[model samples]
Target: MKSIDGISFKSLSSDLPAGLVVFLVALPLCLGISLASGAPLVAGVIAGIVGGIVVSLLSGSSLSVSGPAAGLTVIVLNGITKLGSFEAFQLAVVIAGLLQLTLGFLKAGIIGHYFPSSVIKGMLAAIGLTLILKQIPHFLGVDKDFFGEMEFLQFDGRNTFTEMTYAMQHVEKGALIVGIISLLIIILWDNPKLKKYAFFKFVPSALIAVLVALGLNYFFRISTPVLTIGTEHLVQLPAMDSWEKMVNQLSQPDWSAFKNVDVYILALTIAIIASLETLLSVEAVDRMDPLKRVTPTNRELKAQGIGNFISGLLGGLPMTAVIVRSSANINSGAKTKLSAFTHGILLTISVLFLSPFLNLIPLSALAAVLLVVGYKLTKPALYVNQFKLGWEQFIPFIVTIVAILFTDLLIGISIGLAVGVFFILKANYKTPYFFHKEQHHEGEVIRLQLSENVSFLNKASILLTLHHLPDNSEIIVDGSKSTFIDYDVLDAIQNFKINAHERNIRLHLKNIPEVISTNAH
Candidate 1:
């Protein structure tokens, strides 16, 4: 039951069903992201296949999934226009993959460790809220917007807040019925009593909801033609009827554009941004892992590099480790990489032979699925827990969620990180050295114990403590635990030594280095 790579086949039962759920979630997202990025519709599916198959094979993460992401859509949109053609942009993508591989070798993925836990949780919560807000249009039967976008601002000039009201006013009758029923099915399937049945165990609630939605719409078509939810709001995939036709759609890169300096610049920009997004997604996914396994990040960069490289060669968009699909996989009971691999296989089969059946499923049904996923990620309990953790953790977490709501993911995380660092510095400033008074036979002795590393930031606190010391008291300055002391702090202690003579204060230095202080005449 165990593979040579140590993955257990015993979990296939759970992984296979989880894979079906992910395929359902990823199918529309792949198409929607392509539509948003201005790439060929097939291109997104190609990237998803590569991310699920090739990246899953090479990555150390057991559950994380990768694919064409909305985060990189703007970059691709501008990259294509700047380069003058999609072929030239494809060449840039290949170079970006090489750059990411270099980053893996250089161990640049260690940057993921620096982000605070509060910021990571905030990022997850923001994505959840964005998912709920963004799906409202689709749930109401409006399919004007693209998918996989977490940003508040929409490409169609509507913001996330306003889109809900617009969708409510323009709701489609048939699509609304399917969506409401699908939501109910998913909610009911999640009930503990229903889960006790073997049928619910083998058939995921998401897949069941999609199937029921398809059936409902079909019945409406046959029984009452007036209320039929037609093809307009259904899943749309570019036609690929023949093998020759599919082969023609796979684009080739323009190697002739290699000499241009802008090509290299674009490659570098994509490499840096994609790598950062991948790292952040991997970290968040790791936090959600039920077994609490740590993924090797550098290895993940290499896997993503390979996925992007393959995608570029076949005329696909850039990719990063995506959080939504990964979270869906986890919530569906996935235990290993087999689930992602299975989804890749399913995508290949479905696209090749079942496009007609797929095109029948309504967007409203898929939106309901995402609605539940979003609720779990941004649950009310998360806010209550963060609030209980107090201001230092709560402030950064709240700031990250609010900032991401208005700006974008990367910018919001940066703002939260700045706040987290500020708190670290403030804590260091206040408690750089521990000051205590001890009763002694030879009058009261005051001991100042410097922390392990006393930097320039700690100098102000040390100086204030030295200045406020009672006149003519015995003081012991301890540096035994310090590995390094800043010259500024050492000088303050040395200068204070000068004033000790006037006050007749007995100064005892323990492992404190002597620093010459210039006498101010």
Candidate 2:
């Protein structure tokens, strides 16, 4: 009762409904992420299967969902291009999975806790913005480059801004209609009146939106031949009639790529970033769970490693515990890992029987799905909240967003990390001690109240105050509340005390001990 108390988690109807919701949310994401990364569309579905089936079975998490991440879109795009081939990138993914396994064994999952919240948020916001900007062209049915292409200079000879102009000029009418209709359906389904219905509860809006998009395209083909969407503006799943045909369609990893030097570097990058994203996603899911469950971070790493290894071997993109689908799972009231497993089964079914229908779904509809995802990530509220937190949080958050937009993810994050650290040191410098002044029986009294732990950073502030003490003033340097005082700080106090007679200041110590300064010796 406590788990469900004040919580809206659904009852024991099996995880089927919850799993279906997750599947609905995941399907479009798989295709969208694949499009963004420029990887084969089937590869995203493969990663989804491995994430749902393999990860759920191996992981200790009850609510987390794993799949190809939008956060890794930029990395995949660059890795595929730099490694010379998709097969080579797949090799890098395999190595990255192995690295994750090693990290799990070494208990390096703790590294996830060290990333600054501001920087991580900035990264997510950056990815979300990138998704919207890239998807705009697709939403207008102008598919020139893939979805995750955020680089300023594009391969099509148009920069990021120029691409937008080009997209507006060459918009496809039929795809735009499908996209607008799908988006309207998704938005309208979220109305409180519609959500009260049991049917709406059982089926997710995203699924309904996609289905409507598919039907509209079919209608166009039959009744409005002039507005019919072409193959280039829709999903391309390389239709397969049988298991044998599908087997031939599966791309194999090139084992020869093991010799490439860039493979190892790319692997390291993916391993670290994927591990952080997984840890963070699971942590978030746990907070959302009314039962107050905690996922084992190290175990999650190993499970994800195994999943990625298999996905890469099968020519899938790198995967992680994705927040969007996982949040949908918990909200759908899934009580067990069966929800995740069931979703994987559904994905498998789609791959086997529904590839042609999936191919019929317009790209604009998928773009609409991702547009919502992007909006969630960069909601205007996030900006307002961060700014309210003041300069320390705002500056790094903005720096990370702009840097990632102009540069790439890795470099932008590194730069933001540096800024976050600098602000941390700056805050610490001002918090070393509390200074107070009051009139005493003897005369004007100045007190330096040491913090819980006074370190070397406090020495300069203390010495500067000591130097400015007025003549005939009574000064107190207290450390009664301090557990530890650095030797440098104590030495500064002693040196200040030694010169007190020249300024006619009376120096007193409450709990501080004398430490001879090296200057005196």
Candidate 3:
């Protein structure tokens, strides 16, 4: 074991095993995301390597892992088609990186802070559901659509439910068997007794399951040829011979597309979305850290920006800090960022030397791994807990999930945010001021105390209260505790003041600036 910069060499054993686990988890995902994004398979692998190596080295987060996020699959696909070619889209990725760098320098990473807790939780749950739904087809060997594509409506015109129907009709017995066995292995590995053993602790369940599935499929191919998993149901990495061939495989960005206005727009969009996903993932990962380590958000943004820049130059997809990979890294017993870097190195080595072996792993096994991941994210407990938090919290959470399931991630979150804001406004209107009424010898005495920092959202409530004052009542509009009040609210009060004489009410204002009547002005 060795130690460097607070990362102990003693933990190398732990880190190495964890890295291998993350590498296994990332392999199919990179290929799937790339296929979904309409980019070449090599592009996804390149982004995965860059994210694990470059971004991890530069990020302040100890456990957060970076990769080609599934969240960006839809955006990347559209961007590529709209921009005409993959090479042109790569230029947009470069510009997006530069824009992300600018945002980091400007400290815009704080944008994550404004998202409601409900909305964030909702996003997580939505993604989990998406994973489970999207992977079902792959698990059954229905390869009509790209694997790992999470959008509700797929590009091939098949939605989530429709894909399940298709999968049912086109079920491959070999894949179904592998997927079921792999899922069983994963479930069994989670047993506390099994996990206590050194071999089980060091070796990841997913890796073991995959290897077992591979052996089973290989045996079936020889013994029961008809039951063998076909090429469409397995991983398909581009095999390389020498370093020169690998270098030749790298794609270059089309600089000539730089002048197109649409390219810049796509760049800005990618930068914004990628930055948001990174910040959200970073926040979520920090919360998951057992040590409760806090990550520097701005620094993370800058790291991702630099990563995307390098990836684009080398013909890779856009990169972001992904919650799935990061959570897998932590759960696999990673101690530091070294695990992430190790994963990258493993990915590179696997691509260079073990591509043929990787190609033999069945997609069903990978889908089983993702199914477990998705189940963890959208566990029943999460919904129960959210429901207990009251409607104000639960509504947005549920709404976000449904919207994301029906529409898309960004749109779903937007809808959830809008609903959350409506609740906030309602609460503000209900509690902006306290109205106390007392009966007096002369008339009813009404005392209204304004809350601090009252805003225009309270205007309607204030107007209604003022209008319903009993005839010949004494009303006091007090702003002594308020540091600031919106002009709309103030104007409503002034109008009430002007009408007091006609309504047979006595009006008095305290510590509130008088608003001149329009006729007087």
Q: What are the C-alpha RMSDs, in order, of all predicted structures?
A: 2.4, 4.4, 2.7
RMSD of 3: 2.7
Worst 10 residues of 1 by lDDT: 1-10
Worst 10-residue lDDT window for candidate 3 reads 1-10
lDDT of 3 by residue, 1-521 (tens): 66664366677767888888788889888988998888998899999999988998889898888989888988898999999999999999999999999999999989887788888888888888988888888888775676657677877788899989988998999999999999999889877899888888777888899999999999998899878998988888888756787788899999999789999999999999999889988887777688888888999999999999999999999999988788778877788889999999988987888999999999899889888878888999999999999999999999999998998877898899999888888788788898988788987789999999899999988888788778878999999999999988888788778779887888999999887656332
What digit string (tens of lDDT, one per residue) describes model 2 on residues 1-521?
Answer: 22332122344353677787687668767876798788988889899999998999898888889999977888898999999899989999999999999988998877666667788788778867876787788889886675435566676777766787898999889889988998888678767898788787666666788788888888999999888888877766656667787677677888898888999999999999999889877765676677888888898999999999999998899999987688667766688787888899888888888878777777788777767767777889999999999999999999989887877666787788899988877777778888999987867898989999988876776777678778888989899999999999898888878888888889999999887679884
Ranking by lDDT: 1, 3, 2
Candidate 1 per-residue C-alpha lDDT over 418-496 given as tens digits, one digit per residue, 9 for 90 to 100:
9988877777789888888999997889999999999998888888888789988999999999999999888888888
Which residue pairs of candidate 2 clash? 36-148
Sorted by TM-score (best first), the order is 1, 3, 2
- Where model 2 places Cα greater than 4 Å from the true spot, the runs are 1-41, 60-64, 70-91, 148-153, 240-263, 279-296, 323-340, 455-474, 486-521
